[model samples]
Target: MRWPLTDAARVVAEARVRQGWSRVRAAWFPILQAAVAGSIAFAVGHSLLGHPYPFFAPVSAWIALGFTSDRPLRRVAELSVGVALGVGLGDLVVHVIGTGWWQVAVVLFASAVIARFIDRGAMLTTQAGVQAIVIVGLPALGASGGPLGRWTDALVGGAVALAVAVLTPSDPRRRTRAMARVGVEELAGVLRTLARGLAAGRPSDVEDALVRGRASQPTFDEWLDTATGARDLARVSPAARRHRDELTALVQAAVLSDRAMRNARVLTRRALPLLDPGPTEHDLHAVGATVVDIAAATDDLADSLATGRTPDRARARLVAAAQRLDPFVLAPDDWQVQSLVLLQRSLVVDLLEIAGVSPRDAREVLPPI
Candidate 1:
């Protein structure tokens, strides 16, 4: 009871805090880059370029650098082109039609429609409408110094943001590792909970384990997104090109982790009936022991990933645990026992593949039905 109410709550809290910290750390460089790029754009436009209002400049920079790991040149080009199209069309319409509520609506529609024809990006089209509204609503801003300063501001802002992206120090691998760590740790925690449930033959414990496994999906999603971003960054970033192998491995690990999580959910679902008090006490204990071994193997694999070592020992333990489950494998005569064994076998296969086993080879190592 104490373990369920106190220990479980504490573990969940700690995992969440750790995940939140990792996210903030991964985002630090991008946040800093955006701030610096925005300030530079504003200073150049307002103080140096002598424009009375350079609001669009910083806005463009922020839009260009919403996230730092994205393709810098592509984002810069998109933002600059979008801003120019909106401002230019808005200026033309408002200058002729005169400043009125209807004119603003007309310019926005025209800019959005024009941007859509030029590009398929939602960002581009959205910026087009927003910039149109700004230009139409503020006539003096469009007339400010620097001669079509708003249009030029967009170009300058984008260029500065691109420069910052190119020059800023970043490590996509760090983000990749952070994401993988969370994913693997979550899987390990689920295994540990399942181990406890099987040992106690407590339905409540299995229910807790199932809830935990189901709750882990968002963490797995974060892993996929982060690893994919890292892989993409490695493709275009010169400094990060050297880490392509590591990033790719992380991406694959994220995929494997997804399969493992889904399998775990199924395992949890199947395990519910197995926890009902039954006559096979000896076999239940054996299965519980094997599950704990698998949990240890899971933890070791996670540690190996963090340290960049081959998880040879953990891999061996995982395979051995599957074999160990053989004696405890009750026949389908007892559906609950058979279902739990089969699902456990599938989970082992996923864990093995994640540890570098081929699918065919991993399944061959499973206990006979």
Candidate 2:
């Protein structure tokens, strides 16, 4: 029992380490940007503004920039406004009312209400209240450059963050493409797992495929979000505008692939019951082989999307697989098998659309059941 528990612990630890590494890979660039922006902010506040401790300078810069390339210039401006408003109000309130429990409560309420009135953004209101509380809690001793010195430091930070955001060179499509590849690869894996399960008539394999598909939802969601962010960046950045059409196609692919993944999960779930009563005389090997073909097509589609290449090969393979999804011919007399085929047909249609096929063309590729 101890050995088993130790093994389980080791597996969990390794999985967590992998997740952490993946996050680091995805966020390293944004992290570097934030760090640079903060250092610059602190330098400007401390050197030019003559603030000895200019602590809020780096704080405001880091908060405004954050650790994601998805942030647009407008978002950075909004965050900066939030930080400045919070620090200014906090300093004013602390100077007037002095630091105390009641002062803290009063400043928080006033700052939050004022922030809400100024902007509808939640970050603005929350930051305002939080900064006001910080001001009231900290000692006012050793403060230089007057009561508004900290506020000035925050302004310097905000300005530095805005400058950094505008000057930074970024390819908006890169992250979106990476996320799309991850999503489509996971979808392919699910299909391949489902294929093996169906070919072997193993209910456990089908269950495993279903579990993997469900777990992949977050990846699909992230893909969609990254695509949306790319679109937003294209709207704002001149350099990214040229790729708007490509970004739009990627967004569509993300949506279609998410649907494909959902349909695959449903198909996997439905397949489990058919195989649950132990292996029957009905040979599912051919059906499984068809699923493997679809998985291969999905892999090709992922490669095309990731590399900015034409998906002609993927489309061709998907069209061939689509032609084979005829329930009436494939499953014949077995209604249960026929139902699974129909679900697979839907999944194939989604993949076809992701590969740049029109809805009508994608549907027309499938033989009527």
Candidate 3:
């Protein structure tokens, strides 16, 4: 067996290659922003302020920017405040006790605990700990040998970040669309896997699909959070005003998709036992085909969400596929079988609702008993 570190490296490397560079592609814009933010912070702190070196400015900006898809202003402000708090605390402690191994431990612990006492945000708590370490590890006097200059630099960096956020904001709609796409694709993937497992009557395949479905919950939650942030940004940021409607739709989509994923997980769990060896090759060809079609429709709708296109045909196809799953005819004998059909139909309705259909209309698409 490989060493644990090597195994971890291998897993990370493999993940890099998975998903067709989608993850890497999504990072380019943020990477560019970070580089630019760093440059801007350094320029303002050093050239403008005549500081020989203003390291913390750029560092603060980078830490604040983070990798969040939305909430730039809030993130930058919270991180800046946390950094200031930590630096102030560290400076006070160092002034009294001087810097040493024991001093470093005390400052870090105090700074972190105080930050937690002040706020519960992850960014705030992290920045506090990190800034305390920076203060204890490095000299208190910032470039130009000025006392407490690090705090000023941090303020400058945070101000620049906030300015950039308001002036040249990242497109929250695009990020929301990306999040929604990931969530919808996850659902489609699970459904497609379920279809394949059912068609082959493989209990193992069904079990694997169930695992996949359960694993997709985090993606759904992330989509909801990202969409919520986007909606909030769109509401507040004047630059994002035009995207308000789209962001709102994405927020609604996040909710609908979450419910659909829940139903999908339930369906996958139920399908596993039905496909056990005792069933002796139950013919699920037609139902499987319909499920696969629903998956295709889901993918189509997901792509449309990303592109802001009308998925009229896909929605119609989804409605038709859902309508075909007549539980009375398909799973009359077993309640377990009937439950799966109902759950699949419910999933389709949720997707339809996410596609802009009214709730009542979305449910009406299902076949009559």
Candidate 4:
């Protein structure tokens, strides 16, 4: 017999290749960012003569600058104020106490305390405390002149960072679009998985789906962020607007499907006692298998959406599976039947809506709703 080791190794190698590609791309971003920051610092320092604190200002300004015009101006303002306050506090502590280990202790403690007191930007105040320590510790800079020079430098750096951010704004719109795509993919996965469990009508499969869904919540959050950001990008084109709406609707539909699947699973578990005679068990198992097939189709549809194609077959099968589950109403377990019917109907309607079909069309597609 041929060994399976080679096949397993191939699978592992492919996974590593994908992961390495992602990491390599990510690595380039920080390198580019550092280069830009360094260039600004050097240019600003060289341009201004009497400004004396050129290097500090450019760096500070760059730090203060945000990626887009959309970033809150308030944040830059907060950053500037925080730096100023920290530098001032550090200078004050150094001048009053003089230099020693105790002075260092005072600076750190005061920085931490001031940082905490600032409430919103604790990092700012602590930075100020550290600046004070530098002022006191470095004899070459001296106690008097050095503190002022450092503060001026800090101001210059903030200004440079801010100016760069404002002048060469990066568009966040593409990032938002990418995020929306991720959300759409996740919604599809959950729906497909649940659809599979429904078709199988097996409680164990349904339970497994629940675990998968919980793990997807972070992806849901990421998608939600993308949707919100896309909306904020203020795109005026009809196509862009429509895409945003579709993403929003997709998230809603996923939520509805999740709820419906959970309710249906609970109903099935409760109805297990009533599965009864061998013939009913056989029929139920058959129905469950159909549900599983439907789920597989849904997963395919999700894959289609990611690839920019319509999943018409999956859509049709989902509606058909809902109809097949309808006869469960005739079962002896009245409560279970009612619950399962409710959940099944909800999922069918949501899935249809995602396929751009109206609720009425979905119900008509059902088998005698």
The number of the candidate with the highest lDDT is: 2
lDDT of 2 by residue, 245-301 (tens): 899999999999999999998888777777767566565776898899999999999
Winning model by TM-score: 2
- The residue ranges of model 2 lying beyond 4 angstroms of the native Cα positions read 1-22, 44-50, 105-122, 142-146, 232-242, 277-279
Kindly state the number of residue pairs that clash in model 3: 0
Itemize residue pairs with steric clashes in candidate 2. none
Error of 4 at 165 (Å): 3.8
lDDT string for model 4 (234-259, tens) is 34534345465555544554454445
In model 3, residue pairs whose N, Cα or C atoms come closer than 3 Å (at least 3 residues apart or on different chains), thus clashing, are none
- Considering summed lDDT, which 10 consecutive residues are worst modelled in model 4? 65-74
Stretches of model 4 off by over 4 angstroms after superposition: 1-145, 156-160, 163-176, 191-206, 229-325, 328-342, 352-368
* Model 2 C-alpha lDDT versus the unseen true structure: 0.83
User: Model 3: runs farther than 4 Å from truth?
Assistant: 1-24, 43-53, 69-144, 279-281, 331-336
Question: Which lDDT tens digits does candidate 3 get at residues 73-154?
Answer: 7767788778777766666776788789998889888887888888777778788877877777776554342666676777
How do the predictions measure up, each by TM-score? 0.78, 0.85, 0.77, 0.51
Per-residue lDDT, model 1, residue 286, is 55
- Model 1: which ten-residue window has the lowest total lDDT? 327-336
Computed on alpha carbons, the lDDT of every model, listed in order, comes to 0.75, 0.83, 0.76, 0.52
> Which regions in candidate 1 have their CA more than 4 angstroms from the true location?
1-19, 99-122, 137-147, 169-174, 200-204, 226-251, 276-283, 303-313, 327-335
